[model samples]
Target: MNLESPKVTLDKSTEETFNFLSDVKNFESLMPENISKFEVLEEDKFLFALKGMPEIILKKKEAIPNNKIVLGAAGGKLDFSLVADITEVATDKSEVQLTFNGEFNAMMAMMIKGPISKFIETLATNMKTTV
Candidate 1:
């Protein structure tokens, strides 16, 4: 399944936003307030558990300087890629778009689409204000 987050205009520059996202630990700030657990396993990897979901580990796959950051699951029940795209709007402003691409069977996708889509949207929305 593929989900695209709502575009967000950030007060920081593209480079600044990209730099922040390049560090996997920074994502803890973007998670829901009710998250049950968050652990940084390494500089480029971390695990976070939501209230009802199993802990998921995310690892930094690539950083495209001032352009994008690619992250993916580090072996678990769920496999997915979370990409952050940064576009410069001005010297000190930027627009960010987040996309989630998950590898799921048709049955699983049909069952989790609603909540997963909402989760992706929430992540995008939070990034707007959090950054």
Candidate 2:
């Protein structure tokens, strides 16, 4: 299944925004307040957990400077990828949108659609203040 989050404008330039997301450590600030656990394992990988959810390990899969960053699950019951697309809108202003792609059975997908939807939305919203 696939889900796309609403585009959010950031005050920084695309390059700046991209740089911020390039480091795994920076993601800690972008996570929701409800995040139960978080740790940066390396420059390109991190582990995070939300309340009532199993811990997930994610690693950077692909990156296009000042354009995109794709993170894939490194270890989890589910296989998924999250892509961040960045676009320059004005001088020092940029837009970022997130897309989540997951491979899951119909039952699992149905069960997670709502929670995952909220999770990505929260991430996108956090970008506004945390970036």
Candidate 3:
């Protein structure tokens, strides 16, 4: 399954935004408000659990300089990757799009689609305002 967010323009430059996202600790600012727990596990890993969801660990899988960041599930029931695509718009502005890619059976997708969609959308929304 693939869930994507609408592109959002940010008030910072691509370099600035990329630098911000390069740090795993910064992701806390982009999480959903209802997250029950959050912890930075390592330099490139973090753990979080949202309401009604089991704890999940995410680690930086790859980064393409100031262009994109790919975070993959380190250990969890579901396998997924969250990517942040950044594009330069101006000297101090950029546009970002968030994509959630997961391999889920039809039944699992149906069961979690709503929350998963909301989770990615909320992260994208928060990035637009606070990233």
Candidate 4:
């Protein structure tokens, strides 16, 4: 399954946003308010648990300076990647987009599509203001 989140315009520069996102711990601020647990396991990895889902580990797999950050599941039940694409709009402004690509069977996709999409959308929107 593939999911694209709405793009958000941030008041910070692309480099600023990229620097903030490069730290996996910063993602805790983007998670839903109901998140049950969050832990930073390493410089590039973190574990979080949503209300209903099992704990998930995410690791920063790749990063392109001032451009994009790619995070993937790390030793978890889910198989997915979350990508953040950043583009400079001005010296002090940038646009950021979040996307989710997951490996799931049809039944699983059908079951989680709505909630997962909403989650990604919320994350993207919140990221704008957070930055």
Candidate 5:
């Protein structure tokens, strides 16, 4: 497992941002089509169909409106969750902060860190575009 955190501020209202973030299908739409496929499961969890990626699946374990969400994946043979928070910054802006924390075996740590970081960065960028 690897711990990774990435975040961004969006120039949109909290309600608008929360609405967009609350829907898992929106993430599928925002992701680059060439890189992966996304499938939404019940209760806001999802399975990420990634190509040329080591992890076969990614899951969103928890999501709360306008506050936080947690996603997990078995990367490099270790299970890890990346938690993220969305908070109101002002009347027309919101901030997102991602923090990673999980148990990682020694072997899995190095391999998962960079890619997960990149994924979080991409998520922030894509979310901004959507907002």
Candidate 6:
């Protein structure tokens, strides 16, 4: 599996950050608003209805409050897992780190990284505002 981990610091309390990030709906809102249709399978899962390489629906198979969340995707040309953890640095600051570990060929890995990075950046931006 190829691994890519990125961290983003936000000016928000741990509780406040968790309060927003812990909710699946908030995460969906952070996604590209242009996605034509979106389906949320549960409190921590959603499907992205768009056309793209290795395009596959994603589901939040696991989540731990204020700590970690995991998402699974399988279909199209990809099968992968996205996991993220949140850590508190102070009363009004926190750091969110995400690790992408999955079994995908190098070519596919390179293709998916750009969009996924942007998506995560968007998540950080949105969380910054919400928290």
The candidate maximizing lDDT is 2
Give a tens-digit lDDT track for model 6, residues 81-108. 7776789888788888766667778897
> Clashing residue pairs, candidate 5?
none
Which candidate's TM-score is highest? 2
Backbone clash pairs for candidate 2 read none
RMSD of each: 1.2, 0.7, 0.9, 0.9, 3.0, 2.8
lDDT of 2: 0.93
- Model 3 lDDT per residue over 1-131, tens place: 99998888999999999999989999899999899999999999999999888898999999998899999999768899999999999999999998999999999999988998888899888997777
TM-score of 3: 0.96
Please give the lDDT score at residue 35 for candidate 6. 59
Query: Distance (Å) between predicted and true CA of 99, model 2?
Result: 0.3
Weakest lDDT window of 10 consecutive positions for candidate 1: 115-124
Q: Once superposed on the true structure, which residue ranges of model 1 sit more than 4 Å away at CA?
A: none
**What ranges in model 4 sit over 4 Å off?**
none
The 10 consecutive residues of candidate 4 with the worst lDDT sum are 122-131
Steric overlap count per candidate? 0, 0, 0, 0, 0, 0
lDDT of each: 0.87, 0.93, 0.92, 0.92, 0.69, 0.67
Per-residue lDDT tens digits of candidate 4, residues 12-129?
9999999999998999999988799999999999999889888889999999999999999999567899999999999999999999999899999999899889888988988877
lDDT of 3: 0.92
What TM-scores do the predictions have?
0.93, 0.97, 0.96, 0.96, 0.77, 0.74
Select the stronger candidate by TM-score from 4 and 5: 4
Better of 2 and 3 by lDDT: 2
